[model samples]
Target: MIQSTTPGKMDRLAAFIEVFKLRIAVVSTPHASSPGSPALLLAGSEDEGNARVVFRLHGFSEVPDDVRVVAEVNFDNEANPLMSALPDEISVPLGGSVALQATAMAFLSEAAEGRCGRSAALNRLAEVLMLMVLRSAIDSGAQQPGLLAGLAHASLHRALVSIHEMPAHPWTVDDLAASAAMSRSAFMSSFRTTVGMTPMAYLGAWRLTLARRHLKAGEAVKLTARRAGFGSAAAFSRAFSRAYGHAPADLKRAGASAL
Candidate 1:
């Protein structure tokens, strides 16, 4: 019998952004080489400095603690993948063609302007920059294990897609291995090596991530637990608390307080 590959709705990289709620804040600085050239910089500050452009991933939150900063990069003459090449706070140079730089500069300029309806335009431009950075990172070849490494590996990418497509599925090592067309042992080893976590560990984290969103949206604990593939609300609460450093109830209360 011929086996079918599992269907994936979103690209793994895009799914990563969704799961983590990543956002981009761009600040334009004076170009070092050319005084008049506007150098677009990705910043961590929530405040848009001097009318900077901010682009948020899907389901962005204004709360700083709620946002997870996966990695930070400093663009240089050479473009490289940020996640795998550096530790938590390392800066990597972003290298791209002249055309790419020109396009980015144009977008930054438009984003920085005070035109009406510019927020929407800035958002679109920020999305473009995110893709550009990803492309440059892939081209540079990531040497470390991370989302970048997983994307670069065929088997790992397939596994990642399956996980993201069906987060509620009760997945197992064997099942994921089958999806990736690899033996269970090989799959387990390769996944940990590339993604920097065991398959089940990653799945648990993914589930809790989804659960947080549901809870924030005011879903009942039982419903959120079920949707996140936990056996019971109690179990889900424990896992959620462990991962987020707070009980689900606390988060729910905080969410309510915000309103």
Candidate 2:
């Protein structure tokens, strides 16, 4: 369930926490990274040598696409400490945390048993482990201009929550500034500095992202347009094409083809 602390009202840290939903995929040696996915690496000593686990996070699916963009902008085909750019082959030391060790063992046990009732329990463990990784990254002061930077800034967090919570709302720079309790000029500069995009630009990207999801879910174009805050189907189509390099109908067809 998406947290319901009322978007613009939550404290910065709480707001940040609400934006993640744990998604996990475990692989043995030689893990492959999924594009646009953030992950946590867990590694520890094994009987023979060492063991590793990859917890692939689809958490960004819960965040606005614009926010994801901020977190991912620096990502490239190179090694980086930032989670989004984390190398596929890196083995993160499972820092001697007993609680984490217990949780990891439990997850492995559940996976081996393949019990239906244990899925939720495993998911909760994955969420906890992911948080542990994120906390370590933040505590280490891994400076990457994205979600971490936005979360660190009180004002930017407020604006980000508003955007995430109400992508359908007709948000303007002035309104977002009011939400952040800052002057228009300060809000613009600070948002760009921390989030790497102007408020309106972020909103536009976010809305289009929502529209894409809706379309993929088989929502009609006109309804998707309205729900995504577009003035009309044509406008939404133009913007969607600009953002994603394809028309909504094309995406719908592609989704159908996949099935």
Candidate 3:
């Protein structure tokens, strides 16, 4: 039986939690793009040949397509490949945007979880999958690192790993610099050259991201705030609102009822 705090409200919360958790499970699981967990690629005849589906966690879009997307869930930005480069077929012949939901996550679950240590394994696997996508995209000439070409450098990889491993470690420039085994000045310089943000900013973004996921999973706000390293629920709310454009309460309400 499901747990509940308020009659109708509990049902709504559970539904919201299930939807987001399922999405996370699919994305984080191995074999997310396999036959069993296929991604929905919406593109035109022209796009069919050129389009590729790239899934990256935290720093990248959930489903990065070079076409417009129509789906129930999303994690994209203005820089999203789909928003920027969707093929003409989507507008001309496909009749509308493409929708790919649930199927891909299904396959990912089968391959990633191995039917044991599911969510925990996926937590580690998400980074591996992201790196694979990044390497492939760069090799295939689909993504350009621009002046940030150093982003593909080894230091960037190290920094990413450090952030992922100690997301709640109250990281600072000094801490991250120590992790990267470089002086504060050098680490900051190299990090900016490749990753495009100052160390502190990146840390904040990473923390906010984890907080958002916990929120989606129906974790209590105060708990989520503390785990994400915020000092209090109010602080977490202010930061979350600033980063995501919505208060934690508003987001919880939307996730529960408006999803």
Candidate 4:
């Protein structure tokens, strides 16, 4: 479920998390992770190139290779707007921070517990830890302008969230500026500087992204177009082809062929 948006206290990561359809599995203690295992220690997933993301663990064996938390993270890196905002592979160092060590150990304890709702509990814990790592990345700011840089900005994030929450809406620069409580020109310039794209470009990209997801899921062309902010299926197909180099109907045909 998408978390209810709170005024002034919103969860910026909520939308992306929903797209991930996150799954978690904890490799409890006594199973020592390989010390040189970089792939298992990173908090990212592989791009499996399908609607479903393969189960990829957020490797937590960074320090001392204690325990690893397996997670099916966001694999649709191209479609996910904020994927570039994070480091491709992140492994937070717990050796330097006592608080971080406590946080990591707490989750391990929960993994060890044989209680009711253990799986859900462990998933939630891993989500929190992963969020901490992503939050650190967001807080550190970005050298290149993109979703991370825009999200790190004080005002731009609000506007970005507006676009994210309502992709189907016909968003104008004025509308988005009002959402951010900024002048149209200021919003435009700042957004370009921070996100490296015009607002409309971002909106179009977001719409096509949603459209691609629908197509990949085998949704009808007209319905997908309508739901993804296109005026008609033809328009959607044109834009989708320009972006992804294939027609929307092609995915359906592929799925049909497979079936």
lDDT of all predictions: 0.57, 0.58, 0.48, 0.65
Which of the numbered candidates is closest to the native, going by highest TM-score?
4
- Worst lDDT 10-window in candidate 3: 88-97
Over all chains combined, what TM-score does candidate 1 have?
A: 0.63
In order of appearance, the predictions have TM-scores of 0.63, 0.63, 0.49, 0.74
What does the lDDT come to for candidate 1? 0.57
lDDT of 1 by residue, 123-224 (tens): 556555655655555444458777667666767777777777688888888998988889999999998998799989988976786777778777788899
* Candidates ranked by lDDT: 4, 2, 1, 3
lDDT of 2 by residue, 42-147 (tens): 4444443344443333322333221101112221112221344222222234434666667667766775687887766655666666656555444333255565
What's the true lDDT of residue 25 in model 1? 38
List of clashing residue pairs for candidate 4: 56-71, 57-70, 57-71
Q: Write the per-residue lDDT of candidate 4 for residues 25-53, one digit (tens) a residue.
A: 44444244433222223222123211111
Clash pairs detected, candidate 1: 76-93, 76-94, 78-95, 79-95
Relative to the true structure, candidate 1 has a C-alpha RMSD (angstroms) of 10.4
Go through the candidates in order and give the C-alpha RMSD of each one to the true structure: 10.4, 9.0, 14.4, 7.8
Q: What is the lDDT of residue 234 in candidate 4?
A: 91
Give candidate 2's TM-score.
Answer: 0.63
Candidate 3 residues 3-29, lDDT tens each? 247432112122222322322223432
